[model samples]
Target chain A: MRVRVFADADWPQVWQIVHEVVRAQETFPYDPAMTDGQARDAWIEAPPGLTVVAVDRDRVVGTAKMGPNRSGPGAHVSTASFMVAAADRGRGVGTALLDFAVGWAKAEGYAAMQFNAVVETNRSAVELYRRHGFEVVGTVPRSFAHPTLGRVGLHVMYREF
Target chain B: MRVRVFADADWPQVWQIVHEVVRAQETFPYDPAMTDGQARDAWIEAPPGLTVVAVDRDRVVGTAKMGPNRSGPGAHVSTASFMVAAADRGRGVGTALLDFAVGWAKAEGYAAMQFNAVVETNRSAVELYRRHGFEVVGTVPRSFAHPTLGRVGLHVMYREF
Candidate 1:
């Protein structure tokens, strides 16, 4: 699979992945009922921030966005979020997207990469980041309400590059 | 000292405290030169969020804002930020504001409170939070650029009530 800059035509596929993730209420912090426009504004970032997709045989299977975690002085540290098609799990789409995001941030002069709210219940994601050199910097207890598991912690993961 | 709901008339004083903190660039993540309007827009909370002031004999000595850190699924977890006049530090102004914020979040039925980017070098603020039951859940290495200290970690502090 190859990661590439996203295009306008990629929105339909991107939305599919985002929709699946949000509706599950299992990982992301997004509003499950977020409208198309709202999702676009939230997920498809503008310049200085990047949004990209992973393609396998011309099919978009995963997407990621990266940019400064905060404005002003904190802007030197980059933060990112990702999503993969439900059926695309374990296919390395997420890995490809993560590799691209880290590389992009490093080339852009970011001192670090942070994941602000990785739900602890999202074991696969937590493991994936660990394999990629990310560490669990902290966990906010009972900060996330899992649809079926009640409240859970959210892990703040980080990697210095 | 009394903690009270913020009002339009509080803007000038609020700006004073915010200006001192931002200009110091030793604590908050805001731009040192952030304009009055920009700071106002960034610090003031709208609906679904709350902003308040700590009044000392009719003077606004401190301010705090609390709200959901994310939308939808993660909205149950609350987050807050605080600022006290540089001259007002160590006078129990920050303590009062923290107490008020914690109580406000509890009253609003939030599941927890999280501070996303607390500069590690800001020892006083970190200690203040610890005194009020917050724990250092995680720290992102080199996530903040201290004006004179080069780079420093940003702490993610959390508390559940």
Candidate 2:
């Protein structure tokens, strides 16, 4: 799969993945009932930030959005979120998306990459980040209300470039 | 001082405190050059979230804003920020504003209160939160570039209601 800057054409497939993950209510903190318009506005950020996708044979299988975690003084530290097609799991799509994001951040002069609100129950993602030099700097206990897990922790993961 | 719901009339005084703190470039992550309009838009939040003032004989000595830390599934957990007139420091205004915010969150049925970014170099604020039942759950190193200290950590503090 090749990673590239996201285009308007990727939204439909990207929204499909976002919808699935959000509706699952087991990972992200986004409202499950978020409309496509709302999702697009939040996911497709403007300059100083970026949204991208991973394509395999013209199929968009994963996407990532990253930018300064906060404006002004904290802008030097980057942050990102990822979504891989459920069918594409275990196929290295997430790794590709994250590796691209980290490289993009470093190239953009970021001091570090931080992931806020990573659901603790998502073992695969946690392990993926850990392998990518990320560490759980903090955990907000019972911050996320997972549909099946009752309540789960949300980890604030970080990795310095 | 009396803690009361904020009104449009309080903007001037509230802005005074916000402008001072933000311009200091030592505590909040907001852009120091932020305009009044931007500060108002960010500090004076809308419904499901609250912005209030601590009035001392008609003077707005401090302000507090509270709302869900994250939307949807994470809405049960609340978050708040405080700003007190610099001249009023060590006079108990911060504690009063924080106390009122915590009480309001409890009455609003929030399960917990989390501070996403508490500049570690701001010792007084951190100590204040600790006295009010908050604990540092995690710290992101060199997240804030202090004007004098070069770079400082950002602490994520948490307290359950």
Candidate 3:
């Protein structure tokens, strides 16, 4: 699989992945009823920020959006969110996307990268992040409502460049 | 002092307090050179979100803006930011504003209140929030750059209703 900057043509595939993930309501905190325009606005980063897609033989398999965590003093630190096609899980698509994001942030001169809310129940993603030098700096208890697990803690993951 | 919904007439006084607090670079992470329009956009909340001012006699001494910390599922948890006039420090203005914000969030049917970033070096504000039932759920180390203290942690303080 190869990762490249997201283009307008990738929206349909990206939206499909985002829709499934959001509707599952098991990981991300996005509104499940979000419309195409809303999702596009949320996923497509502009200018200093960026969004990328992972493709396998001409098919978009995963996507990631990244940018500064906050403006001003906090801008030195960056943040990112990722979503892999449900059917493409366990194929290292998420890993490839994360690797690209970390490299992009480092090239952009960020001092660190922080993920504000990683649902605790999403163990696979957490473990993946941990393996890639990220650590769970803190977890806000009972912040995320997992469909099956009820309310769960949201882990704030961090990694310094 | 009484707290009331912020009005257009209060902008001048409110801007003074916001300018001083933001310029200090000791508490909030706002841009030091933020324009009046940028500051106003950041300080004023509309509709579901609310911004209020603490009035002493006939002057605005403090201000706070609050609303959902994030959209959708995360919307259940509200958040707020407060600023008290520099000359009005230690006069319980901050406490009064906190009290009003907490009460307003509860009345708005929020499940809890979460402060995304509280500069750890800001002991007075930290202690005040603790006294008001906010606990540092997690602290992201070296996330904030204090003007004098150098790098500081940003605390994610939360209080469940």
Please name the candidate that would achieve the greatest lDDT relative to the true structure.
Answer: 2
lDDT of each: 0.90, 0.93, 0.92
Residue A46's lDDT within candidate 2 is 95
DockQ of each: 0.76, 0.85, 0.71
Report, for all candidates in order, the number of backbone clashes: 3, 0, 0
Q: Ten consecutive residues with minimal summed lDDT in candidate 2 chain B? A: B67-76
DockQ score for model 1:
0.76
Off by over 4 Å in 3: none
lDDT of 2 by residue, B130-150 (tens): 999999999999999999998
Q: Candidate 1 chain A, which ten residues in sequence have the lowest lDDT sum?
A: A136-145
Residue A95 of candidate 2: its Cα lDDT?
Answer: 96
Query: Root-mean-square deviation of each candidate, in angstroms?
Result: 1.7, 1.1, 1.3
* Model 2 lDDT at residue A91: 97
Q: Write the per-residue lDDT of candidate 3 for residues B76-159, one digit (tens) a residue.
A: 888999999988989999999999999999999988999988999899999999999999988888888888888899999999
Distance (Å) between predicted and true CA of B23, model 3? 1.9
Task: Please give, for residues A1-161, the per-residue lDDT of candidate 2 as tens digits.
Answer: 99999999889999998998888888789999999999999899799999999999999998999999987788899999999888999999999999999999999999999998999999999999999999999999988999878878999999999
Deviation in angstroms for B19 in model 3? 2.3
Quote the B-chain TM-score, candidate 3.
0.98
DockQ of 3: 0.71
